[model samples]
Each structure stands twice: as C-alpha cells, then as structure tokens.
Target: MSAIDVRALSSVPVEPWRNGGGVTQTLATHGTEWRVSVAQVERDGPYSRFDSIARVSFLLRGKGVTLRHRASVIRLAPLTAVEYDGGTEWDATLVDGPVTALNIMTAAGRYRTTVNPIVVATIVPPGCAAIVIALDSACRYSEPDIGTDGSIQPGQFMIVISVDRPLRVEPAHHGAAPPLIVTIEPVPARTPDSNF
Candidate 1:
C-alpha cells in the first residue's frame, strides 16, 4: 500500500440510506466486510443494523447525538469515537440538530477499527493503516515517499495505506482544529479452529 491515498471531499458521491433517514459518502470499502464512510444524520431516528459487524464512529460536526444501545446511552461529541456492536438495536437522538459523523465498520473477527483524534501537527501513528479526515477546516498533508502534497477540506478525507511513513498535517489557517484520523488495521481472522 502507498503511504498516501487521497480522496477529495468533492469527489465522494453521496448515497442515500434505504430508510431515507440520511445520506453517506463512502470513502473506502473492502467488499461487504469493511467500509469507511462519512454519514449525516438528518433526523432523529433509529440507526441501520448490520449483523455480525463492529462499528467505530466519530462525531465530526453538529451539536451531538446520543445513541441508545441495549441498556447504554452513549453520548457522542465532536472528535470522539464510539464503538458498538452492529447487531445491537440502536436509536439516535439529535441533541441540537443534524450531525455529521465518520463511520468505520468491519466484519466480526476479521478486522479491528480505531478512530482517534489528532490534536497536534505531527507524524501519524507508527506502522498503522489509517485514514485522516478533516473536521473543521482545510488541511494540507504532505507525504515524503511520493513527494506529493494535497489538501482535504472540512467533510473530506484521505486514506493512508500500510506504510509507516511520516506525514505532516497543517491546518489551512491558524486556530483551525486538527483533523480526526481513523486507523483501520486487520486483526487476526478467526476460523472454525481458532479459539478466542
């Protein structure tokens, strides 16, 4: 995998949900097993279900959303990532209004996903495959290997392949918030003979 895979916000096409509750822009997907996308919750309603999948979601914008899963009420704020079982029954209540979120879902026992907030301008996590999403403002990112540079605006993101190279992320201007980077690494796949 290359050190950088850039996906512009304008290039990502919007796909509506079957229930018409909201829309999503898919960034990357590995067949039906795993996917990374940005979703907008336009209404306060029940969330879609994906059995046997695990999801890690980060609140990118808007006021907030509280997800009710099983007996837990999880409040998601900006730049915070929350993991939940996709098979669980969950509903979302918008605190202020509509919200935008970065979602990463993986097949159970096949892959593990982590979404972390990037608070400073520095090198990304060492040796980890990840995606960096610009949350508040435009971000200028440069890769040393490819000798390439690009920018992703708010609501835009890019994929970083399995290259442990350093990347410099700079906000378009001062006082702009740092980006939220989501790292999706493959875990040991579970087979019939593999024990937990």
Candidate 2:
C-alpha cells in the first residue's frame, strides 16, 4: 500500500452484475470490506442489495442517470456523486442513454470513503489513502517520498499511499478536466449492537 498501484480500465476485465443489467471493472479492493470499480450501466434496472454496506457512486460518462431511492428521486451527472445505504431498494433510469460511473462501496461500521473534486497542485493530506481517477484527460502524478511518478489516461485511475502513511500528490501537467480524488478512511470502532 505504501507504493502506488496503477490500474487501467481497459486492462481490467469486465464482469457482469449478478442481475446482468450491467458490467463492472474492478479497480481496487480490500477484501470484502471495501471495493472500487467502474461500472457500465447499459440499462435501467434494480440495483443489487448489499446489506450493511454503503455505496457512493460518481457519474463518469453518458448524459446522466436518476435513482429512485426511498421516497426521493436522485439525479446524478458527470463528475457528480451520490451516496446511500447500499441495501436500499433502488432502481435506475437513464436520463438520456446508457451511462458509466465510478462506484465505491464500504462495509458499514468498518470503513468510509469520500469522493471529491480536487484542484491541481493540491497535496494529499497526511494519513490519507487515496485514488486519483482521471476524468476528462490524461494526468500525471508523483510521490516524491518514494521517488516514483506515473501517468494515467482519461478513465484510468491510480491508488497511492497507505492507511498508515501519507503522501503528496501533484498534478504532473494540465488537462481539460481535473481528476476525482477518492479518499479512504476508517471509521471509529463501534460496539456490536451500535450499528444495528
């Protein structure tokens, strides 16, 4: 985890959802507790239920999409994210056509993940494990501490830093779009019955 792990979307194999409504290319995962992936939403359908987990999704491509969650109709657009209880009964409707998105899910009571739009030249805070996802164009990054540097094209992403260690991230060059910064942090310990 200390060293960077770069994963390309095209290099990752696509796996169909259990319901077969869409497909996903897993980018990174830590056991069953949390996972990051890019999903291709080919059709509107019910989302699979994942009890005890919370999901955060970012619209990466396509026109947009809307979700019927609880009593609310949530809309999402490119570069935007929405988080909800993973077990909720929800269905998706394409705003214009098929869609692609970045998805992060963490087991409730175990971990938490946040997706934010970061400005170029910003340094990742200490003790933060992060993923830089290229959105609109290719971008480069460097970890001076490790003397390592790399680049990822649009739609690709890289995971750097460890939970125990922090690293600085600077944009290598300018691009049309900024990358989506995904920060992973652990939740405080909770009593067995506290989350229930």
Candidate 3:
C-alpha cells in the first residue's frame, strides 16, 4: 500500500511557452511512452495542446466553471469531475469565482482514469489502484486482516494496495458528516503486440 498527501504535492509553475494559459502542476511525468500530470488550474484560458492525451479535472474549491469543448459545454462544480480528450478544442469560463481544480492528464491510449465520489463502507476489487481524496478531516478508512488503516484530512489522499485481490474499506464512525473518497484506476493493459 502507498499513500500520497495532496498537500505535500509540489507545485510546478505553469509555462506560458507551452500554451497561452496559466496552470500549476502538483505531479507531472513525461516519460517516453507515457505522460501524466496532476495540476491545479488557477486561470481559465485555452486548453493545453497535446493531441493524444486524456484529461480529467475536478473542481476542488471556489465556484464552478463551464468547459466548452467543440459543441459540448459542461458545467463543473466542486467535487465534480469532467473528462475529455486533449486533442479536442476546448475553452473554459469561470462561473462563480476563481476555482481550484485537480487535473490528471495522461497519454491518450496508454492509460485511462475514472473519478467518482465514495461514501459508506465498500470493497475494492483486486488489480485496482484506489486513490481516496478526503474532503473532510472527519473521514477515516480501515481494512481488517489486510491491516490497512488511516484517516484522510482535507487536502489529503491515500492509495490502497495495488493488487488483483479484493480489499475491504470501512468508513470511520462519524455521527453525521459523510466522508468523500475519490478513486482512480488505470485501465487494464493490453497484450504486448496489441496497438495502444
């Protein structure tokens, strides 16, 4: 099992040369075969230029934003995740106010990610990578027998074991407030000779 605190993620300044926009990245990897980055969008402008990349953005703070992709426009609110192909032409507009969003961009065909809100106790199937991003400090997670236990505070996250066996996860006892968990899973790999 591995853990990553969202607050501990280092910030990389957005480069204007790459695109006519302002964005900050907390995690970024540009390997020869794969490209992935988790970023925070502080300003709205033209989207990044990467023909074969997939992007997932979740609003973390402030008002939501409306993303215009080709002829499709999607409104994104806090905790809401919006995904699209990077090659598509897209534009964004601040809706309520300045927004802070969590973004994950990866090589188009190499990988894919899904973002969803988790509440209540649940079990994670094997061969999956689970990322729980806590929205409230009152949230907690525990796995019996497997010995996985911890609490997720605001701006913090945890990743359960990467395995092919199912794992259990229980929410800590909190009278009222429900914890929000975000799970990220990489798409299953294909055969060696398969075209990505």
Candidate 4:
C-alpha cells in the first residue's frame, strides 16, 4: 500500500451489482480503507451507497450520462470528474448507450483523491501515491516498465509510487487517446491543538 504496483485490467474479476444495473472491476485497494475501480453500466439504475466514503467518478466511454440527485442533475462527460459523498442517493440515465466509468473512493477523512486527464506526456512527481489508467488507447510510460514494456491497454492500470523521483507517461503511438492520472494522498489527522 505504500509503494508502486502494476496490474492488467482484464485480469481483474468483474462483480455484478446486487441491483444488476452494472458490473465493476476493482483495480486496487488499501484493504477496507479505500479503493479504485472501473464500472460498466448496462442499464439505468441507482448507485450503491458507501456511508463513510468520498467518491469521485469519471466517464470513460459512451456518450455519457446524467446523475439525478435529489435536487440537482450532474451531467458526466468523458474525463471530467464529479465528486460527491458516497452516501448520496442518485439515479443514472444513460445519454446514449452503455457507459464505462472510473471511480476513486476513499474513506472520508482518511485520504484525498484527485484525477486528471492527460493528452500528452505527464510527469508524476515524487512524494505521493498515484494510479495511471489508459483512457483512449494504450499508454506508454517512461520507464520502470509497467504493464507490458511500459505500455498498458486502455482500461488497464498501474499504481505504486516512488518517493525518490518522478515518473513520465505518454500516449500510444497511433490514434492515441488521453490517459488519466489519479493522485491519492493521506489526509492529515485533525487535532484539538489548532485549526489547520
């Protein structure tokens, strides 16, 4: 959980939701503390609730969808993230057809997460934990050989971070699509000492 790890998307097992609305593949986890996953929405339905978690989601494929909350509707576009409480009740309406989405969730107050879409080469600096996902096509890495020879197929991912230096990432050679970088940081503990 403290260092870098790499994985293939196809190797993960997909679990169907209890409501049968979609299937999800969990790529990584810090045990019960947090998780990163990708989901395929096969139909319109309500999302599952996670009482003490913070959820950030991004649309990876399909036209997109509108998340209907109690008093508002949030439209999800490819690569753009919409963060909300994991306990929030929402229904999804597909804009076109089936949708593929990525989700980053952390136990509230335990960690912080940020997701960014990259169209060109990107450098993941040292000191933080990060996960890189191939979005458009396959992705190429500068070194440390994640996936296959520094390349991972679209939807495949790698994680594990080195505190000693930064890692560079780039798109595939032809018809490339931007990849996404997710940075995860531990939230500093709050004390009665003072307001930070």
Query: Which candidate gets the maximum TM-score versus the true structure?
Result: 2
- Candidate 2, overall lDDT? 0.77
TM-score of 2: 0.84
Each model's lDDT:
0.77, 0.77, 0.59, 0.78
As a whole number from 0 to 100, the lDDT of residue 92 in candidate 2 is: 87
Candidate 1, residue 32: CA error in Å?
2.8
Over 1-196, each residue of candidate 3 has an lDDT whose tens digit, in order, gives: 4332333333334543255445564443435433333444556777665688777777767778787877788777777777777787778788755776767676676655666555566776655555665555445555555676666665455554353455555555555334444344567678899987
Candidate 4 lDDT by residue in tens digits, 21-113: 999998877777778889999999898888999988888888888888889778888768888788878888998899999998889888778
Model 4 spans with C-alpha error above 4 angstroms: 1-3, 142-149, 153-155, 161-165, 172-174
Q: Select the stronger candidate by TM-score from 1 and 2.
A: 2
In candidate 1, what are the lDDT values of residues 11-57, reduced to their tens digit?
88899988888999988876786888889999988889999999888
C-alpha TM-scores of all predictions: 0.79, 0.84, 0.68, 0.82
Model 2 scores worst on lDDT over the 10 consecutive residues at: 163-172
lDDT tens digits by residue: candidate 2, 1-196: 2667777667889899988889998888878878888899999999888999889989878988888986878777877778778888789898889898989998876766788765656566556567888766666666666666667778678876463344555554564767778887877787788954
Candidate 1 residue runs with Cα over 4 Å from true position = 1-3, 121-127, 138-156, 164-173, 189-196
Instruction: Note the residue pairs that clash in candidate 3.
Output: 126-164, 126-165, 127-163, 127-164
How many Å off is the CA of 96 in candidate 2?
0.8
